[model samples]
Target chain A: MSEIELDLISHLSEYKRIFSFLTAEDIMKKELITLTPENYLSEARVIMRDKRISGIPIVDKEGKLVGLVSTERIIRALEEGIISNKIKEYMTPREKIVYFSPKDTFEKIVETFERYRYGRYPVIDEHNKLLGLITKHDILRAILKQFHSIYIHDRRREEYLNREVSILASDKFIEDKASFRYDINTQSISEAGEGTALLKKVLEKRGYHRDFIRRVSIGTYEAEVNVVIHAGGKGLILAFFEEDGVVVFVRDWGPGIEDIDLAMKEGFSTAPDHIRELGFGAGMGLPNMRRAADRLVILSQSGKGTRVEMVFNLKEGRD
Target chain B: MKLKEVMNTLEAKIYTGEELLEREISFGCASDMISDILALAKPGSLLLTGIIAPQIIRIAKILDLSGIVIVRGKEPMEETIAKAKEERVPLLGTKFLLFDACGKLYEKGLRGT
Candidate 1:
């Protein structure tokens, strides 16, 4: 097999082990847009169309989860001339559905996904109250986040990069040791990867191995985009090049993550609707960064800032 | 088998990149989940699915798929069509159901890689 293809097979299988370590609650969409069974069918239809959501939970007057109204049901209703009816008349009632608890892991969920072919499953607690929703897209995003842990930084890292750049540059008759940096504007997601893009091209041009370049690029891009989506303020990405790998430090000043433990969990995110809709937030960014690098260290102060240091070792398969 | 042969078997219409159908497909995959395809589809395979969204093109790009057959006669959004055209990924629509289209391709020598 070609080296790149064989490398992908090894990497993807390794990712399967890394990704199976989480439960449903860690990634479920907590801020829900729901419907009431008593509400007219038109309301659900409007919300689905407007929000680009395929399904919405139906709740009772007391906010207990009751059922779901999916696009399929709506289409069936439209064909049957039931659009004027209340959601209770056509929604898939709770008792007949396949739902998940907060404790179910992706290993468990993948079976359901493959067996049922449903687009999403609602997440509930012991009381059977709807806590949030988890979709195929969410699970996929979270899992694939691990799939590409290809890799990237810090003070020791800075020194290492300096040493490598100087040595590598000498071969080309250049003498300056330079560490790369980029300013990440929280509001400028469209431009978030400008730094990482150039960095990858430079490394590739410098004849780095394909696997090594991908690891550094993916890690740096994730860190850079995380700052743009979650940090709530301008941030900076600094890259260090070493002989064996790359290190990146994503430092941001903002309302820092309150719980580093919680933040490190896959599918954890506090990004608002604006960022989520723009496809920036799936709660996968940090865990992805963790897996991308061989060694990862996070430093943050609540109401202050966060600094994420990542190390990518070309020889190591995964941590 | 070539993507063009699969197209003729399913009686599908090329929505974008018609000139590219003569290219050979290394394999065939049937899935609506973009993430699964992105995570697992081998490069240069043919993807057959019922999903009609722009995300399909992105997944195709990530996997470097040979082409896509949107089964069940679903038309993608205009923007999705535009994206496929720009990305140079062949996108097609078939009147046959997803299972039937896949079966036809399988019968005509397309196997999952």
Candidate 2:
């Protein structure tokens, strides 16, 4: 689904492939109960009740997902006596909805569900076509299906697989490693660095030294700002806590940097004059990231996207 | 210097974090470019900038700055005020130009980081 997947897969161990190879498309329910934007909340309420489903995806005539109306919205509309209103007025808009691509790995979907705490997420294609819906039950069923093929006769192995998959699905692994991941909304330039700010707060609460948090947050902020300024307004920020350091990744599906070497040079910027007016695009984003982190590697393809991985060692003092 | 003293030095107005006026700040940095601020700013320093975007509030929270002094008496956007209130980052406004405000703070024995 993505070229970057192979690069990461090649680096992971053999056992990790089991989880990485399986994706949302493989597990998501193809048959879905969906509604159109023109549908009324009264109609949606009756459909949801008859189908016994808590939520439904709202799509256009072209089958592109436009919104989602959950049971909570249904109750709110009923309370407000607006049950007869159109579904668009009562649905969570597409811009705010957390969705998954068909090609996304199971681990990514699990992590997203854990982060957003949503009951279910719509699976869509690159064209925004509503492909399917994924839920926690779907994830568990996928794990079961995997185990059924391999450990059908081995009860012990089945137990181990169950334990492992649950660990992967829940926040247990993240809590143990202190990994923090967030989706960066690049649509608004003013909301940049929010993930980094939250990271700073978490590190502070965990008793990290002020300078250590500052270095990590500074590096993360620069990378995130790049996503907002250059990237087409969608990015992901993931930080994995190591024993003596931290690893952060900022990935954006933007036009990849044509020449990373030139981009790394101080004061080299491709940003236009309008962006410069907002106090960004000074050509210092990469250099600042380099200065703040102990090690920085930027992986990018011309037409695909750019992924910046920064490593910070706690034992090392500031440069 | 206490943040209150810096507020007095610039004859500034507080937009948020009024309860944090008693906090001590040692250094001051001024910049219109956020990258420079993130690259060069030190922890516990005061940030003086001509910008009032919401990202400034986030940067202040990340850098653990003592406060932000919006130079040139510019009105911060409503979203910026909301973010500052949420992040609890002290935000103040000043009528003096960026250069004069920095000079006044320097004259008062507040050094740069």
Candidate 3:
């Protein structure tokens, strides 16, 4: 079971204690660097440099967060023009602003931080006046406290699971249940087939990035085509994602590659002449997938199937 | 030079963020490669690039670039222009090639530090 579920089951009472200790207002930094919209971009840079901050709240005369200014905006202005004489010229105006209040919970703040990838958020009062700022560092500190609590709760959960397991064994003949089943197959082929489109759609639905999905889809399609035209049979392709990364296994049961190392070279395809005429095969499928995936492993036996397993890291913070 | 003056000098069209043209920038970098511009350009610098793609505007958004100048008379697609507009990033286009545009700006005393 996941740590979160374990905590929920074994430490329901301690959860309330954890909640009571973490309030949004407790983590906010009351001091913030503020700038007026009338200031020049150079002036904002100075403030940012002195404050050692990447972003600053742009305020009006009333001290409300009218917008935000960052280093990126400064660089953009210099490229667009030599100089921007005022902050309003380059300041990102306040629209779709996400702010937090002191009354909000730490969990909600964490959710917001994760969703937006914001390093810091401006804290506002009831009048929408800027009160302070809550940064990722502050959130991290709060989460650390929760982590400690979770650790203790997890220890208790292990004890509970142990006790439950003992009780289950005492009750004998408990049925074993299978939650899900997946069938994997591998084959080699040298021509493109109907499965290419189906595999592409499946990977797309599984939430791969568009660029990566395209490259993998093309690579897999080429591999399939290679199996049909050169290897003379369909290749096998299987993939599953674990917490650590995605694992894909492809194999071709056709006549095995004689020179695996030579075949791995770029532009080294054994595709038949007719397959080459279609402008689909360029002898770069294996190399392309190798470049795209975090790990690539291949095993082949003479006159037997060739197996290829590829693993791609679940890129952090992408979700 | 102020952004207003640069816009006037280039006779460029502002597709969006008209209200922000009065801002000031300190330096400038001219490049077509997004990665290079992101790495080399300092904060508060203007970016001049000849590449016209939605990815350009998306890069501007990620880097929080104040504005983008599309050179070589290349106009951004309508969707790209709209994305820039929505992000409140000013978009400008000029007929001059990359080198000449940078040179003219340099001649106009917009030297990078």
Per-prediction DockQ? 0.03, 0.53, 0.01
For residues A34-101, could you state the per-residue lDDT of candidate 3 as single tens digits? 88878888887777778788788888888777888777777776787734578876777777567888
Instruction: Identify the leading candidate in terms of TM-score.
Output: 2
Candidate 1 error regions (>4 Å): A1-180, A186-194, A274-280, A316-319, B1-113
Poorest lDDT segment (10 consecutive residues) of candidate 3 chain B: B33-42
lDDT tens readout by residue for model 1, B1-113: 87778878999899998899789889899876432353346668889887776756755654567898888988877876898998799999999997888888888877886
Model 3 TM-score on a 0 to 1 scale: 0.31
TM-score, chain B, each candidate: 0.95, 0.98, 0.91
* Position A147, candidate 2: lDDT: 45
**Which 10-residue window in model 1 chain A sums to the lowest lDDT?**
A166-175
Which regions of candidate 2 deviate over 4 angstroms? A1-178, A316-319
Off by over 4 Å in 3: A1-21, A144-319, B1-113
- The candidate maximizing DockQ is 2
**lDDT string, candidate 2, A1-319, tens digits:** 1345333333333234345557899879989988998999999999989999889999999999999999889999999999999998779999999999989986677567545667789999999999999876677677665542221111234555555332122222343353798888757788777788778878788887788888898999998888988897789888887787777878899987887778877889998787788888878998888888866767665666777777777874642
